[model samples]
Target: MPLLRLLCATLLLAAAAHACRDGGTSGEPPPAGGGGGGGGDGGGDGGGGGGAPTTPGWIERARENFEGGALPASAFAPDPVPDDGPFSDGGAYFTSRGVTPPAAFRATQPFGKDGWLTVESYSRRGDARLADHAEVVADPAGGANHVLRLRSQQHTDGTVVRPTAPLPSRYRVSLRAGFPAFGDGEAGGNNGYDAGDETAGPWWPEERAASQNGFYWLTILDALPRPHNNTWIHHHRKVVIDSDNHHPAWMETWTGDEFVWSGEHPIMMIALDGSRPGDVKTGNAFFSWSNGAWQPSGAIRAVDAYLPDRWYRVTIERDGPRYTLEVSGTFRYGGEGTYRAEIDAAQRCVWHYPVDAAEAAGAAGCVDEGAFVEGHPRWPAGGAWPDWFMFGDPHVNYYEGEVYYDDVVLEVWRD
Candidate 1:
């Protein structure tokens, strides 16, 4: 078997043995944090003093109506046999946070309010088994005072949580996330696996190192409309940050280790379409690891950089097929500033060209050339809006890192 396939088969086997864990294996550092209030003012139909008003009735009633629900014991069956794959790599990792859909909570609709839904109860798939590492703790800043923290030690695991109800199509989601200072083995290092060992024989030298590169992601996902089979489509919009450039070729093949950014910067991306499971075409919008700064992805770029160890308000808004993302805080590149982008959904398509085609003609042999390809579309034509949204890292691997999230709020606009 080819090295890539062999590695994948090994991961699948590993996933089958365990429930999904969260953590990332690719990308560059995220921005530093130290400022207050960044992002564009919510406008269009939901415009207001503080953007669209929070979805009413969601905040006050979420705990009462949404909390305490758990997945069926059957839903927790070993990897791949359950409703979704048992492994935590793709949509399964995101949807499996607390309760799988089709359940009572999964069917709960928005309260028809224009306010925001606040998620207070957070859970992970193997928290009970990994209690020593994954947990929800009080935020040092106080107020609602709770935050979800995920730490990994020889394993690339993470935590996830979902709102009590589904989010509206036209909505703004906001949250605060933080990362610790980079350390050896925290970002990029072999996870104590000897390269020549029998167990490591299936992986390439680079794969072994890259697989242990510690990283984290803050993501938002939605179920796509499957008019073809009346099924569900899973897609992700995520912010990825790695500790260093030592990532697997499969994860960062287009850029490679040479372009790996410092752990302090974060890359924002949206995955639209692809052929393989969880193989969505990823497009970078507002950050780059190549230069250790925020640069434009197409016509969009970050006005400022992000910092580590500090908290910054990250917000995402969708208007029609266009998405506007904003980040505000102290940055290493642009100083106390805000970064923003206005992107169309069609811009996130993954492009393919004939190999051996000339560069002048725009063909670079099957390669992922970034986002905003003019003609290709990620979503199926005339597809319906997504029915669900999820947050957290879904890729499965073994690495070590920590990430924290707090003050998560999602607001929808109803006609």
Candidate 2:
């Protein structure tokens, strides 16, 4: 089906979006949170003159804490869809959280009024499993305060927790997430994987390092704060499958990592009015990983360093032409502190209006190229392109780990 816009805070609907595949690999990456409150105006002293209506700083809002727990279990088996083959560096991770239909199609109200959330998952075999307790559990983090959890085992077998509704075009979202145990890539170093075997030559240098380091987008899409627009996520209704699989010729044959962003009535993020980003920097836009978490960057600044079990309160927002990223978590170095940066065009978050500034900049060292959208670019879907936020690994090849999520809030600036 399409990217449904069903925002019901109180009602419940059990459904799923099917991106059917017939096995084999190859493709590109695919990509909500919660609730509301009035701001700026506080309850002043009861004066003789009535105070003006307390205006909310945000024009629209949606949030999810998973406190009410999950809705009743609902199982879905998507009917087989046509095969369309692989997307750019595609690996078979297709997911959408809270995959409910539109208000007219299902019972829905404004976003976040619904205290419950829904989850849907798919494998490459055109088979789908929806609403399994093991996949999504509320309050698994050991608090009556509650939290949302998503876990994936297979390389390409992942799930998503869709929200009751969508966030506004221009919005600020905040959430807490944790990767309990990120595998250490250095086999012979410390942590005791091979113990004393200093010569661990199982994988290629790049593959070994990449495998040890969990990815922000290589697996999980839209888990943290990033810019979004009409070009949210584009999935094919009919997935293409190549009978004779072979490794692509690499950089010389590099056409684009976003080949899946094109072709036919693809599902997700495509506006009803027909708008797609000419550039491939919106969803799965690149960032640098350092000092544990994947720090926001203009160009690619990645070293396959390892990540241990840790938690952080992550906030990514777009205010006008500037993007702000703030992360705070307990670290081995200085315990807990906040690291924030407000990025603009000068930082090379993007090169030129066209993405040709230096396509092959990786030859030297990775340069800041792609960037997140500066503001909430409108999507005709009645909300953001996806109109949903995902909370688990959505890619098949790289990371297969658990992500703990809580207290998600999405907001639209009043301006």
On TM-score, the candidate that comes out on top is 1
Candidate 1, residues 1-415: lDDT per residue as tens digits?
Answer: 6999999999987875564233333243323432222332221232234454544321211121111222212121123312332211323433334423221101112211232232211112433242333345655456545565645332323233445455555666666766542223223444333331212111112234333333333334443211100011123332222223232222221122233323323333332332222332223232332323334343222133245557776666655445666666666555675556555443433221011113213322213323232332333323233423343432233333465665555655554
Worst 10 residues of 2 by lDDT: 237-246
**Weakest 10 consecutive residues, lDDT, candidate 1?**
224-233
Shift in Å, residue 245, candidate 2: 27
The lDDT values for all models are 0.36, 0.33
Each model's TM-score? 0.48, 0.48
Query: Model 1's lDDT to the true fold?
Result: 0.36
